[model samples]
Target chain A: MKKLSKRIIVGVLTLMLLCSSLFIPTAKASVPYDSYTYNFWLDPVESPNPYVPKDEFTGDPTTMGKFNNPQDLFITKDGIIYVADTDNNRIVFLDTSFQYIGEITTFHNGDTFNKPQGIFVTEGNHIFVADTENQRIVEFDENKQFVREILRPETELITDNTSFRPTKVVIDGAGRIYTLAIGINSGIVELNPDGTFQGFTGASEVNINPISYVWRRYFATDEQKKRMELIIPTEYNNLFLDNEEFIYVTMGNVDVKDYGIDVIRRLNPSGINVIRDFGYGSPIGDYFVRDQQDITRFNDITVTDYQVYTALDGVNGKLFTYDYDGNLLYVFGSNGARQGNFKNAVSVEQYQGTLYVLDNGNNSITSFELTEYGSLVNNAIKLHYEGKYEESAENWQQVLKFNANSDMAYIGLGKVYLRNGEYKKAMDYFKLANNRKYYSKAFTFYRRQFLGDNFGLIMTSVVIIIICILGLRVYLKTKKINVQKREVNGI
Target chain B: MSTYISTLRYSLYVIFHPFDGFWDLKREKRGSLSAALTITGILILTYVIRRQYTAFLFNTNDIKELNLILEIISVLLPFLLWCISNWCLTTLADGEGTFKDIVIATSYSLTPLVIINLPLIPLSYLFNLEEASMYYFFLTLSIIWTVGLMIFSTMITHQYTMKKTLLTIVGILIGMAVMIFIGLLFTSIIQQIIGFFYIIYKEIVFRF
Candidate 1:
C-alpha cells in the first residue's frame, strides 16, 4: 500500500510538470519585432505592441488560385476586401473572413487587365481598377459590369515626355477622382466625375537652399550642371480620401532633408496642406534611423473615419499610425519572413479596427487585430476628438495601465484635468508628457490660483515691507542731521 | 576673512565704475584670486540652480539626463579657455595684463550674469508663456551687460585703444577655436597610439 501511494505521488508530480511546460510555450509566444513610439525627444520608446498578427491569407488554390504579387488592398464600408493582383492581372474579392468570393479578370467585351496595380471600392459598391501598364482607370458597377474607362488625359500640363501609368486612385465624397500615376512629379491628377481632366493639386514645392542654389547657378560648369540630377517635385506614391473629403497623400522618394515635412500631406479642397504637426515629433515613420537609406519610405496610406491614418513603410515593412494632430499612436511590424512580419509591405487598408497589409514579396495579406491596449488608446483619442474629455480621461488612464510611457495618454489626461479645473494635476501630467505648450497653459492657471489663494498674505507682506522701509528712511535722516549738528558744534 | 569679503564687495564697484575700479583692482591690490575663484564657484552654482529650479514651462532641458559634473565642466572649461586665450593674445599685443589679471577681470565682469540671472530664476516661476518676453528680455539684458563689462574690463586691464582691444578680442576667439582643435587632435592621436600598442600586444600573445 505504501509503494502504491508513493508511485501515485510521483505520477502526479510528473503530470504537473508537463502541464506547466505546455503553458510556458504559449505564454512566451511573443511577436517577432519590437513595438515602439517616439518620445518628445524623438527617441524611440519601446512599449507593448498595440497590434498582433491575427490571420494571414495566401489565397486558397482550390478557390481562386494564389495571389501573385498583389500590389494594393481596399476594404469597403461593408468590409469587402479587394486585392489588386498585379502580376495576375486581376482584382480578387474576399469577405472579411478571408474567404474568396470571386474575381474580375475580363470585363468590357473581353478586355483583360494588364497588371492592374490599384483597386478602390466606392460606397455605392462601384469598383475602380488602376490598369497600370494599360495606362487607364477602369470602373465597374456593383454587378461586376464595366462602367467606363478613363484613359490618359489630353492636357498641355501633362507634357508628352511624361508617361501616364496610374498606380493608385482615390475618389472623394463628391465623386471627384484623384489618380497617382508613375513618373508624374507634378501632383495627384484630379479628374472630374465624367472622366474629364481637372488640374493637378498638392504639388510638392522644390526647396533649394542658398548654397545649393548658388552652386547650381554660378559655380558648376555647364557639363557638370548637365550631369547633375534635375530638381523636380516628388511624385505622390499613394493617396486616401478621408471622410471629411480631404485627400491624404504619401510620397516615398522625398529628399532626405524634407523627410518629415512633405512626406505625408493632407490636401484640402483648394489643394492647401492642412495637416497639423503639433505632436512631439512630425509623423515621420522612424526618428532614430541608422542611415539616410534606412529612412522610412511610405508606400501606402489608409485613413479611418476618425481621422486616424496608418501609413505603411515599404522599406522598413512597418505600419505607423497617427491621429489627426500628427501624434504617432504606435509603430509595429518589421521586415522579416516571420508570420507577423512582412518581407515587403506594399499596401495597407483598415476595416473597423483591424488592419490588413498586402505583402507583394510574399504574395499574401496579413491582418492585425487590435489588442486591449490598442483599443484603449483608440478610445481615448476618439473621445478626446469628440470633445468628451470626462470619458476620455478614463480611457487614457486605462491606456497608462498598459503603456506607462505613452506621452499621448499623459497629454490626453492632462487636457482632461485642465478642463476640470485641476490645473496642478494637469501640470504634473503635462510634465510627464514633456509637452511644454500645454504645461505652459496649465501653469498659467495654476499660478493664478496660487496667487488668488495667498492674495491677503501677499498684500499684507507688501504693506509691511513698505512701512518698514519708510520708517528706516525717516530714522536715518534724523540721525544724519543729529550727527551734522554735533560736528558743527565741535563736540 | 575680512579682506576676502572686501575684495568680493569690490566687484560691485568694478562693474559700475570699470575704468577706475579695474585699475585699482590690479594696481591697488583690491581684488584677490580667492575672491575671483569664489565668484566663479557662485556662478556655477547659479547655473545649476537655474537649470533645476526654473519653471517647467521655461526649462527645456531633459532633467533625467542632467549630470552635475558635466554642468560644472561645461561652465569651467569655457571660462578657463577664455582666460587663457585672452591672456595669450593680450601678452603678444603689447598689453599690460597678466594671466592672473585677465582671470580676475573676467570673473569680476561676469557678476551681472549672476546678479541678473539669479533673481530671474525665481521670477520665471511667476510669469506665464504670454509674458515670457519680459523674462527673455531680462535674460538677454544680463548677457549683453556681462559682455559689455567684459570688453570694458579687458580694455582697462590691458590699457589698450578701443580698436586694438576689439582686434585682440577677435583674435582671442580664433585662438580659442584653434586650441580646441589642437586638443581634439591630440586626444585622437593618443587614442590611436594606445590602440596600436594594444593590437601589437594582442598579436604577440596570439602568435606565442
Candidate 2:
C-alpha cells in the first residue's frame, strides 16, 4: 500500500508539472503594449430630442444601438455628413454644404442589412455600417454605388467552424483598419483591405452557438436579437477616434443599461492596457462595461477641434459633449419627443460648422450650428481622491436632477458612504461602481476589493489540505508496516 | 465466429459485470482521480511533444490540422481513454475489469454511432462528394462523435444510470460551450480593440 501510494503521488505531481510546462508558455505569452485612457460621454447640447410617436410611447418595445433611427454622426473630407438612417435601412450622406447628396439603400436584400446601425467613412472614401438587420455589413463607394462587402456572415466561410458577425467598422489614418464583429465571442476582426481573417480579436475559440449568438446579441437594438446576443461584452457597437491617443467604443452587446456603461470602452492604439472607461451598464457586462455606466448608451462618435460628440439613443434621447479630460461639458435633449427631442436619436456628426442628428422614430434629421459648452465638472477621480465629498455630492445631485443614470454620482455616493462611516452604504456604492459593465484599471482595483483576494487563497489552501491528507495517509501506512515487520521479526 | 470476434465479444460482455476478478493484483483499490489524471497527463505530454518537437508532429502545417485529424481521433481517442481509464478503475480501484474487456465492451459503444450515421457515409459516395457532401460528412461525423464521446465518458466516469449520465453529459457540454463562447468573445474584443487603436498606435510610434 505504501509503495503504491508513493507511485500515485509521483504520477500526479509529474502530470501537474507536465501540464504547467506545456500550457505555461501560452499563459505567459507577453504581447507588450502601452494602453491609455480616454473620456467619452454624452454631449447633450448637440444631440437633441426624445421622439416616439405618442403611439410608440404606448407600444414600441425596448431596443438600442446603431439600429434604425440614427444615433451616430460623421462627416467626410468633402464635409458631407453621413447618417446610418438605421431604421430606414439606408445611408443618408449630406455634402459639406449640408446639401442632401441623395441616399443609398441596402435594405430588402434581406441579410444585406437587417438593421443599419453605425456608419463610417475612410480617407479613400468607403462607407461601412454596423448593419444589425442583415447580420452582415454592406459597403458603399464614394459614388454611392455597391461595393463588395469587406466582410460577411462567416458561418461556413470559416473552415474550422469559426463564426463572425461584424457590427461596426473603424478606419485609422494608416488605412489598416478593423471590424468589430460578433462571433463565437464578441470581438473585432482584423482584415487587411482584402478581407482575410489576419488574426482575431475579442473571441478566438469557436463558441457552441457562436453564429446564433452573434445574430441575436449583435444587432443594434432589436431585443429578439438582443436576447439571442445575451452573452456579455461580445458585441462591438460604435467607434470614435481623435488621432491615435484614444479610441472610444460603444460596446452594447453586454446587457448594460446603456453607455453609462458596459456599452462603451476607451482603448489605446496597441489595444493593451485599457486606459479608462466611462460607465457601468450591467453586472453581466462587468468586463465589457466601461466606467461611465449610469447615463449613456452611445453609438456614433464624431470629433472636431473644439469638442467630441457622442450620440446616446438609450431609453431616452441624449447627446453628450466632452473634452480630452473625459469631462462632460453639457448634455442635450431629454426623454420626451419634441422638435429637438429624440424618441431614439441614433446618429450624430459635425459637418463644417453644423451638427446633425438622425432620430430613428422622429424619422427626421435635425441640424445644429456648432457651439461650445464650458467644461462644468472635473473628473470624478480628481474629486474623489482629493476628498471633496460634499462638493462632489452636490455636483452629483445636480446631475441626477437631469440624468439619474450618472455613474459619477454612484462613485460620489460611494465616497461619501465611506467618509461617513456608512460602510455598508459605501460598499453598496462601491459595488455599483465595481459591478457596472465596463472598467479600466481603476474599476479593476475596486473589483479586487469587492470580490476580495480571499477566494483564491482559500482555494489554494484547500488544494494544499488535500495534498497534506494524502501525505499523512502515506506516512501512517508506512509506519504501520514498519511496526508490523519489527513485531514479526521479534516473535 | 472468428476467435478474435468471439473473444472480443465475450470480453466485452464480461466487463459489464459489477466487478472483475480476472486480472492479477496485489490488492485492489479504487482511485477516481487516477483515471481522469492519466488522461489529462497524457494530453499534456502530447502537447509538449508536439510543441517541442514540431518536426515530429507536422511536416507542413501546425494546429490548423485539428479538424481533419479529429475525424479519426474522435473514435480512437475515446477507445484509448476508455481502455486506460477502465484499466485504472478495475485494477487501481478494483473497477470491474481488464483493459481487454473494456476495449471490447466499447467496440459496441461505436454501434450507435454507426447506426446513426451509416447512411450518410454511403450517400457521400453517390453524391459528388466534393462541395456539399463533404460538408455534410464533416457535420454528421461531428454529431456522431459528440454523442458517442458523451456516452463513453460518462460510463467510464461512473456506473450511474444512463439517464443520469445523459443529463450530466449535457451539463458538461453546456459548460464547454460556455467556455468556448467566452474565449471567442475575448478574441472578438481583442480584434476590435486592436483595430480601434492600430492606426492610432502606428501614427504615434512612427508619427505617421
Candidate 3:
C-alpha cells in the first residue's frame, strides 16, 4: 500500500508539470506581439497594441462615439486621438489610451458633417475638418463648441471651373491653411487663417519633352494651342505638418520620367523642397522594385517629433519611414488580412512611440509598437542624421549583427567611412547599398589615388609617344629628300 | 551564298580601309543590297539582345515592361528614316552615289557597332559595379568608330571633298527633321478628319 501511494503521487506531480509547461507557452503566445513583414531587416515582435471598437461601437448606432469607416487619425501632443469617422459624419475623440472621450457630430446651425475625411487638431486644441462632400471646412474650439465654417474662397487666381471639393487640409505654424482639393491639379490651395484666399503652394513643375516643346513653341498655331492639353501640375494627394511647421506633401501621380523630382517632398516656408539626401536614396519607395504597379503611392504622411516621418503607401498598404534628411530608416506593414497587416492603409500617425495606421478597407486602426531592433534602428538613424557618424556607425554595426541584410545599416557605415575619408571602404559599402551618388564620389577619390600612384609611368609613356612621333616625322622628311635627290641626279 | 558571304566579309575590311572599300562596294558592286540589309538586321538584333540580357547593374531598362516590337520599331524607324533623308539630300547635292549605295554604306557603317557591341553584351555579365567603366569604354569606342566610318564612307561614296561631305551630312540631319515634322502634321490631319466624321455620324444617329 505504501509503494502504491508513492507511485501515484509521483505520477500526479509529473502530470502537473507537463500541464504547466504546455499552459505557460500558450499564455505567453496569447499576449499581444508585434509582427511586421520585412524586406531587408528582420523586425521581431516587441508588443502589439490591438484595438477593438469602444463601447459605443460595440452594439448599435445610437451612441455618440461610434465610428463608421474612419479614414484618418491624428494624435496631439497630449495624446488625444482625433479620428475622422468618415461615413458616420463625425469626428470621434479618444483619450491617450484610446478610450472614447467625446465626438463632434454636428456643426453651427444644425449643419453636420458631409463625410469629413481629414482631421487636424492644432496645439491650441482647435479642430479643422475637411468637410469634403459639403465643400467647406469646419473648425471647432477646444471646448467642443462649434467655431466657424470657412467656405472655398473665390479668387481670380483659381482658373475657371476649378473644383472646390477639399479632401485633406493642413495648417502651418503661421496660421496658414493648405487644402488639397479634388481636381485641383494646380497645387495645394493656400488660405489665411481668417479665411482669406492665397495662391497655390509647391505646384508640381511641368515637364515638357524637348521634341514637343519645340513643336509647340514654333509650329502650333494659337487655335492648335487652345486644343492642346494644359501642362498643369499634378494633384497633391496628402500633406503633413512637421514639428518645424514645414509642410511635407505626397504626390501619388508622379510620372516615370521626372528624373530629378521625388514623389515625397518637404517644403520650406517658401515652398521649396529642403530635405537633404545623406546616403539614403530618394525616400519615395523601394527604388529597385521591378513591377511598375508596385511603385509606392503615398496617400498620407505623419511627421514625428524625432524628425523621423512615415508615409502611408496606399498601393502596397505599407508604411515607409524616413528621417529628416529623407534617409529611409525602416519599411514595415503590408497589405493583408493578418493582425498587423492592413488591407488599405490610408493614414499613419505616431504617438508615444507607437504607430497607429488607419485602414479604410476594414475600417479599423492597427497599431505597431517598436521592438528592440526597431528602436535600435530608429536611434541609429537619428544619430546618423544628427551628424554623429562614429556613434551611429556603432549602432548600425549592431543592427547588422541582428539583421545582416539591413541596407540602411550599410548606408550608415558607408557615410561614416566617407566622413572619415576612407574612400575605398566607403565605395565598397556604397556599392553594396547601391547608392550611385556616393559611389561616384568615392570613385572620384579612388581615381585620384590611382592617377597619383601611376603618374610616373603615365608621364614616361606620354613622353616616349611624343618622341616617337617627332622621330617618325623627321625620318619621313629625310626619306622624301633622298628620293628627290635621286630623281635630280638621274635627270 | 559565297558572294553574300564575301560581301559581308568585305564589310570588315571596309571599316579599316573605308576609302577603297566604299568605292568598290558601290562602283565594283562588292557589297550587295541583301548584304547591307543583313548587316542592318544584325545591328538591330544586337541592340535588342543587349538591352534584354545585359547585366542588371549596367542596365536601367525594365525587362518585364519591354515591348519587343515597339523597341524594334523605335530603332529601325529612325535608322531607315536617316538613310532615306541622307539619300534625298545627297541626290540634291549632285552626289555620285545611288540610293542603294547610300543604304549599303550606312548599313555597312553599323558593322563596327555590331562587332563591338555583340561581344560586349556577354562581357558585361562578367563585370562588377566598379569594372563597369571598361564596358562603357568599349561602348564609346564602338560609337566613335562607327561615326568615323560613316563620315569616311559618306566622303568616298559621294566622291565629295571633306568640307562638302560634312555640309551634306548636316543638311541630311535638317532634312530628317523636316520629314518628321511633315509626318506628324499628316498624322494629325488624318486624325482630325476621322474625328470629324465620327462626330457627324454620332450626331446623325442620335438625332434620328
Best candidate per TM-score, number?
Answer: 1
Q: Could you give candidate 1's per-residue lDDT for residues B1-208 as a string of tens digits? A: 9999999999999888988998999999899999999999999999999988898778988888889999998889889989999998888888899999999999999999899899999999888789999999999998998899888888989998888888888998999999999999999999999999999999999999
lDDT of 2 by residue, A129-239 (tens): 766555555666777666766545334444434434555667677655566654534355556665555554433222235556565556646646534433443455666
Model 3: per-residue Cα lDDT over A1-491, one tens digit each? 99999999999999999988876644325323233322322222222212211111211245453456787788898988888989989888777556677787766777889988888888898899999988888888899889888897889777755457888888777777898888887778899989889888888777778888898899999999999987767777888988888888888776656533577888887788877666335676666553465777788888876678888887787677777676666665567655665677788787877777777777776666665667777778778667788999998888777666667777789988988888889888876665666666776676687779999999999999999999999999999999999999995
Which numbered prediction scores highest in lDDT against the true structure? Answer: 1
Better of 1 and 3 by lDDT: 1
* Candidates arranged by DockQ, highest first: 1, 3, 2
State the displacement of the C-alpha of residue A34, model 1, in Å, after optimal TM-score superposition.
1.1
For residues A53-162, write the lDDT of model 1, one tens digit per residue.
98999989898988999999999988899999999999999998899999999988899999999998888998999999999999999999999999998888888655
Q: Which of 1 and 2 is ahead in TM-score?
A: 1
Q: Give me the TM-scores for chain A across all models, comma-separated.
A: 0.92, 0.48, 0.71
The reply for model 1, stretches above 4 Å from the true place, is: A1-28, A468-491, B204-208
- Global CA lDDT of candidate 3, please? 0.78
The C-alpha stretches of model 2 lying farther than 4 A from their native spots are A1-73, A86-89, A96-98, A106-115, A129-138, A145-147, A153-165, A182-184, A202-231, A253-263, A276-295, A305-313, A352-354, A370-491, B1-208
Off by over 4 Å in 3: A1-65, A106-112, A133-135, A154-165, A183-185, A204-234, A252-262, A272-296, A305-308, A323-330, A447-491, B1-17, B20-142, B150-208
Task: Give the candidate order by descending lDDT.
Answer: 1, 3, 2
Scored by lDDT, model 1 comes in at: 0.90
